[model samples]
Target: MLLSCGQPLPLLRHTDVPPRVVENFILTGYRFPNYSLRECLLSAFRPTNETGNFWTHFLPFFIFLYYFVEVFGWEGAPHGDAQFFYPLWNYFIGVFCLLMASSMAHLLNSMSLVVREVCFFVDYGTISSYTVGSSLAYYYYIHPRAGTVETGGRNDSHMDLKPEHAGSLTSSYAILDFSVFFETFYIPSACVVAIICVLSCCNTRQRWRRHRYLIRTFVFLLPFLVSSTPIFYRLLTRSPYLSASSSFAASTSMSSFFYRHCLWLLMSAVFNISKFPERLAPGRFDIWGHSHQWFHCCTFLSILDELHMIKTEVRAILLSPTLLLPPAVLSRLPGPTVASTYGVMFLLQTTIISIIVWFSWHANSIHGPERDQLAKDHPKKPLKCH
Candidate 1:
């Protein structure tokens, strides 16, 4: 009954469209390909399988964007030098980009085979960039070495402290500092891993479409695990129940939130790979309650928890920089290096995906619908995702 531009744009059955757009266990509610851009945009409001997927992240995109403006207006300019907040800015941008890219991909990928391929690649690239952004924030804010800065004086209240006196807090008690070797290579290695994540995921999606669910899951999980190593180390080695210092107490609180985020991440991944409840009753969940929808919800929750944890960490550092941060690290806060590195990594991954998608578009264009028909006839088995 749905209409696009006053014409009825009916949903299709599984057989009505190409196999590439068909999700396992979902038999109806597919939009036809080659829809105009207007129709594709309007599809978000229709009762299609992808409508949930689109809104899950699209709605959160606005929420995250609002928070970014809120944080920038309320926290960044009024408190101290804006340069010190680059890590937070980078993290916020990553959340924004990933959510928006994912929502748009879901809504618009049905436009054509080429658009489908390109849109998902763009999604993968944004996810990879987000991992690097998380690492950038982690390196400066969450890593154990940077966790608890010892301010020599106990002012008891962070409210009374001045930004100019941040450098004077000179205590150095951390949960545990790693070898100098690890400290030097952490950020660089994370950037490398992010690049690998994109390459491996794109390759698997292109080459192993039939059984790529697990392979793709592994590809993305590796970077998340790698990026979260610092958080894991802190959780395993330190007890949050005991508060060692004011800064340590704040770090422990951040760890608690990290633990919650990890739980949400785990739930998201499980839903993504298992294809639960929906798989138990095919076609029943074509328009709702699908595993992919749950995955989006869990991941969005995880992002929210991460934002809160970072906010707490930022507050601690700003309130008593000298007490909570080391001189070497604190001195570098005013530079653009952290955000600049994130920019470079973001650009690198996006460039690689763009190249891959370009070749894909041309190949699909050359082969045209004949190749798609052949794909449908010999349809790859075990399609695991939506």
Candidate 2:
């Protein structure tokens, strides 16, 4: 169902800046200043400014939903294999939550400032969740002893794994490994989340508004620092398993995984910052070819890219018994087939989106003072189209 392109959605601007094709615009905005939830969602079927942002995320959720249901939801991840399959399921949870949060944020962002702020909160949290989920895969696949199979023979499995592999490998899955790995990321990511929360509170404050997107990009990229630091450290320090060609390849695979994730993330940031085609040509780029759309697409692809990397590594660890370590939760996870994980994540997001919409609608009614006051403080010239 195609709607007319360049349909105007009432954009509540705080400045005299010209309007871009989409950020918060909806199809129904052409009909009325503020549309109902029915109109906002129905607009998803028709074209609008929010359409790209919405579909960029909207489509990914369905992919993730099917993956969780058909693959992780029904698959059996039995003994000694819990780490790989279960963590993957959880990672999908993070991916979809992120997609949903971002989708709703774009969809309702034009509805009201109050709604936008709430969506921003969910977006920030989802980012944190995705980071954690991505990193946990590292815990499973990038063990310190990854190169052991190459250093020694398959017979080496008879001996104690960590000790035998200690000289050639770093002997991962220790308490310290878990601590350093998670602490470095969790602390910084949480800080970013907290900062995002504060930024949301200052939503109407024009001082931070000028740099909001920049600040967000900065925080969004910060977690990469924590994640990348350790990967490089291991790649340099960990010995390569040169004897067996495959072992050497497997040993370095974790680095490849991180590289792919970083590459896509970098692309996402570029799309976000450049606003390229859209920036160069004003209204011409409105209906399509914007940075945010590229950003969303890049982000979606990145998740899949890393997921592939993690899957390969998990297979390596399981298929090669020499690579397996003693029982440790460093990479441990619940049963993948446990239907509850999917159910919980689905319910949690549904509840959150529902609550956000309800609150936003209510906020729209009473938020006149706040919105008007903010607008007064940062008034924009009336739209040329109007």
Candidate 3:
């Protein structure tokens, strides 16, 4: 019979007892460890190999959640239309879910190879869900048509009309426009699909040979083709509702710029080949400042940058005279003022971004035993640039 000897495990000192135990003790589920209260509280917050990963992602989610609730919970606050509100809420929910999934994945992935596989799959799924949700939110509310209400012999449009339309005889018209369908849906979908497909391709060996070529082709061609959709649709339909420069159009333009400039293309190549810094440093980055984490941060920053540009364009459109219909059409709308709504949104964004930055800084500062283990594993590799 084969004999197995388990390696000696570290004992839990009173001062270094797991936070979970401390939490349980507070809940009366377990007796308190023989440690000072101050020490217990500090230890509870201190980063451990397992808890550090969870908290890193979890902190961002909590920050976002705080702002999300503040931004969306006020029933009478003036900022956005009902059409915009629901989609925005959904988008925030997706983000929350993604953050939770990421936190869980990071926490459990190192438990074992099997757990790592499961966590990775869950993380990828959450990412896909978030991408789809965000794209859908953008698509759903780009231009919403409001219903007319009869109020005291007046026709009230759902949106506020411009001041110049006060004396207009005709009822202000709000058209159900689907002018930039391609830019709103197709381009974003293409980009997201290309990203997910490439990421997935990295793992599957059986489909790798055939899917690799298909993915590459799609990633190269789809954005341009999809972006042309809005232009073609506008030309073919002669729709006045379609802006010559819509948010979707702007995002597609940025995607095109990135593609042509070879940033995404190079990143895609790097991802597919798994070469250079990643390959050379493999387990070296299994902990802090890994290439994968860098990749995630870069992808998030790029998307946010594009979305911010699109949002700025949207704000400009909202403020444009041409987009505003006549008033008498605006009196029936139930909402806060645009300025107030956007102001709250701006505040929320600022707070959340600040918190995320702080959390990231805090996470970066903590050096755990796992990091030391990684260093021991790859002592000769060049230090990773954060």
Off by over 4 Å in 2: 1-33, 64-86, 143-207, 239-253, 321-367, 370-386
Query: Which residue pairs in candidate 3 have backbone atoms (N, alpha carbon, C) closer than 3 angstroms, thus clashing?
Result: 78-336, 79-341, 157-329
Tell me which residue pairs clash in candidate 2: none
lDDT of each: 0.68, 0.54, 0.39
lDDT of candidate 3 over 175-246, digit per residue (tens): 223434432345345445635443553333123544543453344344434433333332333222223334
Ordered by lDDT, highest first, the candidates read 1, 2, 3
lDDT (tens digit, per residue) of candidate 1 on 2-57:
24235545689998887777998888999877665877888887889999999999
Encode model 2's per-residue lDDT on 23-141: one tens digit a residue. Answer: 43212222222344655676776655567888899888787565444433332323533534555656666777788988987777544456555666667667766665554445444
Off by over 4 Å in 1: 1-5, 68-81, 147-182, 236-249, 323-343, 346-350, 358-386
Q: Candidate 3: where is the Cα deviation over 4 Å? A: 1-81, 110-115, 141-278, 281-286, 317-386
- Model 3 is weakest, by summed lDDT over 10 consecutive residues, at 23-32
Instruction: Output the better candidate (1/2) by TM-score.
Output: 1
TM-score versus the correct structure, for each prediction: 0.80, 0.65, 0.43
The TM-score, computed over Cα atoms with residue i paired to residue i, of candidate 3 is 0.43
